[model samples]
Target: MTAATDGTRVTIIGVGPGDNGFLTLKGKQAIEEADLVAGFQTVLNVVIPFAKNAELCPMAYRDQEEVLDYAVGQVKEGKSLVVCAWGDLNVSAKELLDRVRRRVDHVDLVPGISSVQIAMSRSGISLEDVVFITLHRRDGKESALEELVYYLKDGRRNIILLPSPYDLMPAGIAAGVIEDGVPGDHRMTVYQRLTHDDEQSWSGSVSECAAITTDFSDLSIMI
Candidate 1:
């Protein structure tokens, strides 16, 4: 395959919501063709089989800069690579890729089923009729609730991407909505570890959910 200047090319592959079955054919092909496969440990594990011949570089969310540096070094060495990501790479890897792109000129991205789509599908809700918001990268304690309230006030169904923050979880989201004038009886669902074999989902009213103190996984989704 052709490469950019200095021979570094990056292919960002969306591995889907923590399930190997969700990986697209194109994504798999990219992995098989790459010389390096890099991403979070969980995603790296899921894609390891396809990257049998490629070097695997595992990194955590906080290690994004380090991972990008390593990837750039490999690309400069003329290695073809595929970077795995949970859900759609564009969703969680936006900030990471944004920085990497400034260094690596040739980049390609393959889309996969995002957790947002899977949550909406499992809930049997039409995305066209819902308001979508993501607190995944934002400081939830800041404007997350305010923006949520604005949409919640519209009365349209909402599909929110919650961050793993103390005050923006399913319970906290419910409490915020209830305090924003929505009735406690409003219905919503919390989908945990979405799309995985052990995935679990809970449905309840806002008030009922507010009483829950059980912590959810980092992959949980609320709708």
Candidate 2:
């Protein structure tokens, strides 16, 4: 369904990594003004305080379509809707943005800070010297893994990667890169729960990371 022609708009706002403090001013204003807000429960929780005036619509992967459709219907009724996403929309949230765009004709995006930026600051890497790849999407991970390997082999730029939580996590990604001819001794750092109080980071050779058995948080990035 398309957005209502009476100027009602659906906005997709990035809530910024896991920390609400990182939320941008524009993003905060959008959420605060929304009539209906929808997002994964975790993301919604981060923006709950700012979305005080809106009806909360928490959704999971299995029911995201239904929830988004409901938000669109609300927009049709002349109410403003905001769909929250974790991190910056330009980074790992393209899939979510694509889904939102498919259901609404006029969707405004408000970008927020991404964990990748946090990782960069923590690792002292410049954005121009880094290539980012996220395996966080629902599908097409094999090619993403290949792209990671390809970049790793290039050896000119550092990589900031968001691995798939289900598989291809830090260890799996390290192993895959090593198997694909990137040196096992290449330095790698894994940052977990960035921008949060319990944030943790581990830095070691690719082989060491591949051998790691310790469970890492789902909110993790590798550099």
Candidate 3:
């Protein structure tokens, strides 16, 4: 299906975690070809160099819907568009992708490396032994928490989880899992700003992570 009534395409490109070098070649090409580009300010910053020819539309949580609506209008006017997201679209940007799909007939996706992949690589964990979960959505915290508890109790596979930034950050997630009967002594590591030059990490028992007082960067994942 074509993206809009005018037959222009709408592509959603995952720009990788933080570093521009991680962006896939196809993603760069899409950005270079876009008539308009839209995404969160941080994501836009990562792709700005490739999008010199495209109109950049940066949005925050408060204005994302409005910004996307404007993008959809532009697409209908026959402009090829690209919406940027951090990490692989299938991993954590499904909600954003769905939003675009609701406004257009079809949307193309280009996957990029995720922080989860970087974490697994750094920790030497195989994908076959991990269960990935993201708590970054606007809703369904209860269900996601229940799933995390179930996995913790199962004890068969390691977990790589992306905590919700606004509420359930690293400490909050560690506490919640412990309260739900996941052992406080469970070993965990939190990685922040993966792929960035100043990336950092903390490793400790769940109890120790729960007691952490320092505010973590918004870009962080626990494994």
**Can you write out model 3's per-residue Cα lDDT over 47-150, one digit (the tens) per residue?**
99988899999999899999999988998888888999998888878789988888887778999998888999989999999998889898887898899999
Model 1 sits at a Cα RMSD from the real structure of 2.7
- Top candidate, metric TM-score: 3
Cα RMSDs, all models: 2.7, 2.3, 1.9
Question: What is the clash count for each candidate, in the order shown?
Answer: 0, 0, 0
Off by over 4 Å in 2: 1-8
Candidate 1 residue lDDT tens string, 1-223 = 5534534569888889978999999999999999889888987888998898998988886887888788779888878878888888656556656766777777788998788888888888887877767676634445766777777777766656565545467887787788879888877788998878889999889899989988977788877
Ranking by lDDT: 3, 2, 1
TM-score of each: 0.90, 0.93, 0.94
Which is superior by TM-score, 2 or 3?
Answer: 3
After superposition, the stretches of candidate 1 with alpha carbons farther than 4 Å from their true spots are 1-7, 139-141, 165-167
Runs of candidate 3 with Cα error greater than 4 angstroms are: 1-8
lDDT value, residue 47 of candidate 3: 96
User: What lDDT tens digits, residue by residue, belong to model 2 across residues 1-223?
Assistant: 5435635468888899888999999999998888999999989989999988999999999999999899898998888899999888898788889888888767788989988888999989899999888889888888988888888888999998888886778888888888889999899899999987799999999999999988888999999
**C-alpha-based local distance difference test score of model 3:** 0.90
How many pairs of residues collide in model 1? 0
